[model samples]
Target: MSSLRLVPGTPDAVLSALTAVLDGRGTPFAPVPADPAAAARVRQAAAPDEPLEHDCAVVLTTSGSSGEPKGVLLSRDALIASATATHDRLGGPGQWLLPMKPYFVGGLQILTRSVVAGLAPVVAGDSFTEAARRLTGPRRYTAMVPTQLARYLDTDLDALRSFDAIIIGGAATPAPLKARSAEAGVTAIPAYGMTETGSGCVYAGEPLDGTSVALDDGRILIKGTTLFSGYRLRPELTAEVLRDGWFRTQDRGEFMDGRLRVIGRVDDVVISGGVNVTLPTVQARLLEHPRVKDAVVLGVPDTEWGTRVVAFVIGDPGRDELRDHVAETLPRTWAPRAVIRLDALPMLASGKIDRQRLLEELR
Candidate 1:
């Protein structure tokens, strides 16, 4: 029986524990946040008394956006496979800049890649520019969400461009943001993957080496060495998603020009006014508006429409104007019927919109 340890989820602590686990010198551990509530949840999920399976390296939890977060178990082999594939895609790893919290897959993979490269990662401390200066590698890489890129572009263009490539995941990169990154010569690569795939296996719409992607009725199915072993203590849940060598993902995707184009989540589509509407389409249209900086579109339960299309927006855009803007490209019924303007969207610690919080506002 493999013992599980609950390591404190600090960059140094988690990194140290992870290093030991990867080196086969320590017990299988779960990194728990220092925050009381979050730590409790992680501890409960990990359940250290329950022995882990063979070769389990580290266990990480999901963002728990929809509901209860599940613990994802990853073996040392899977972690090494992911790091090797990432290095192959990124012109061989030199050194990584750790900008995100270490507990999440994106940040964890940065450390993993650095380990595989036999190079120490430069943690992007309070100052990104200072951290960029410390990257002594021939090839530099970092991972961040869309929000961080926008902020860095506004303040530190040179530092942002210092890296050979920047991996953007955890959320959709707005079209405007993508254009800005390109214009700034930032070499931002949009990645698509989740905790299940052990971080991103696809970058810039291309699957990395040792990773295979297929579509099942428009749903994205991934099969590769980068896949996680199973959900810790959740056998039934593991069997539900992992079939054969393929792991089923909930995101909808399409092959466009021989590249995997992730449309959105499977549940992003909702029937409003008896017409099916994809919320991301409406969200994208709102983002294209000059006056709108950001937007989140959601379908809410309503008596009249069965499901009402609602939008939470940032920037100074009028509800009617935004609705008309969406209608210009999409069907009139697909446009958000209700629009709530906000100064800024609430974000999770993982750099994703707190969508469940947005739904709470409706209640």
Candidate 2:
């Protein structure tokens, strides 16, 4: 067994070590190796005299949800705990297919799990069929964002069901997509978590083994052994989010039927006439409509009410009829005051709804 440690070093060293490991070559395991003579330097320079921890093995970059990247320190134990929990939840680890890049935390988790599970992950290229063929045997797993899942749905159902379970994360999966996936015999688990929580603490709709979830001031708080130590060199930020050993995620969620349902970012909510409106909830409901293929909701400036709830939908339907359809099921206030029909909804590179871009287009 190789002992891992965190050492203060440069990106070249870190990359070299990663390359070595990926190529089956051995390298020193340290959180930050201080010696310039070491095989490789850390990705980020470390202070020579700074206090360094030896147990941390993985350094994850924040998702930049709040517009700035932060480094998350993770110990080997934490990463293993997360992978083990996922394996247990999925009923044993098998072959994994990576349709996404490994530089991301989600992708890294898949690669790490493959290594931990003693299996090599198949990287999908131009051929989806080739990827499906690699997923041989009884158990198979893959991780994809909602957009990828949607795109896969547009492809072949047989290829989509090739996996035993597909963990969907990186964004809120609309209810319609989840339903369609189940109908297609694909086990699509909508995951909720951030880099601070070591990928996803909640899977399907429940917290993984040993992970605890609670709400503090409408913000979801997660506490678990898998939680990252803190943002690297940003004590103020780390203190702001981490309190009482719980990571305060910006996301707001509710617990229903013993499962967690993430509503949206707390800031994503808009208040109109003193009524709080969750954009994601409205979009989710809109997606439930038979004609709507995709939907995104945002708040637009309104003179009468502080902000008006506006929705951009990708589908063909009369605005009144769609409004009535939404009003019939959801609360009247939750219904979008204005529906902007669009050929398609804007998406981020991570496959999330680009609300900022949509708002710009609407304006």
Candidate 3:
């Protein structure tokens, strides 16, 4: 049995190894960030010496937002399929900009897409304009989390409009940002997928060409060539999710007008004051306010309410105003009971909202 290898090298170095792996010339490996703290969680989940699965191209370590971290094993074929389909969906192959960390699937897919497109990726180092200037391809693209895109929309419109398409993944984007992007002539594509699906298989509410999205009792079920092979050295856990070629997602969504509408995770609902409050719904409503930049709605333990709904936000929206905002579209009981304002939302290396850290803040 061949052991899994770990690559904690610089971007250029990791890209070299990744190129070989995708070409079937190198062994199976996991690319981790160079930052000690960010890379530490990946190190704990990646069993470098453990036996690797056959034909495994990359093992992406996930911090599991809520649960323990796990290594998601993806094959070379799946990664290539996802990249190629992404190019097809976006009109054609083009150069990509790597704005996020190089290790996670969101950033890793940018590198993979570049390799598939036969173009070198331009790394966006602090300045979006500098990176946009480096793009030599006729068609240009980049992927960003909601937070990064929100910042760019406020600071740089010319740079944001330079790209043909900007894939927004990592977390639920604020409604205000979407309106601003559209009004500013920036084509921001909302993406959905996790490391287990070889990055975003569904872009802007539709499944990519080789991917299929179905509803399993209102739960999201995806299957296709872009799917991960299994979890690294954890077949039992892998069996729990991947069944009969379909990967069960924790999210519950519905399709209206042929486009998938994600309705938050299955466990996203909490009973507060004898009412079912969907956290994402409340969070989405909070984000619609023009003054609100970003928001995260969560349910905490409570003796009276069973689970007290709280809103941790970054912006100038007051408690009463936010509560009134939710009551406008949603039930009045769905409003968050407590409001906690923060300078910025906690983010993980993968560009996902660090829910664990946010929960820690409440403690």
Q: What is the lDDT of residue 293 in candidate 1?
A: 82
Off by over 4 Å in 1: none
Q: Candidate 2 at 286: error in angstroms?
A: 1.1
Shift of residue 6 alpha carbon in model 2, Å: 15
Residue range 199-300, candidate 2, lDDT tens digits: 888997799998999987778999998888766567788789889988888888888998888878878888987898877877777888889888877888
Top model by TM-score, which number?
Answer: 1
Compose the digit string of candidate 3's lDDT tens values, residues 92-170: 9999999977788888899999888889999888788888889999899999998889888878789899889999998
| Model 1 residue 282 distance off true place after TM-score fit, in angstroms | 0.9
Lowest lDDT 10-mer window, candidate 3?
A: 1-10
Model 2 off-target regions past 4 Å?
1-55
**C-alpha lDDT values of all predictions:** 0.89, 0.73, 0.87
How close to the true structure is residue 143 of candidate 2, measured as C-alpha lDDT? Answer: 88
Which wins on TM-score, candidate 2 or candidate 3? 3
What TM-score would each prediction reach against the true structure? 0.98, 0.82, 0.96
Backbone clashes under 3 angstroms, per model: 0, 18, 0
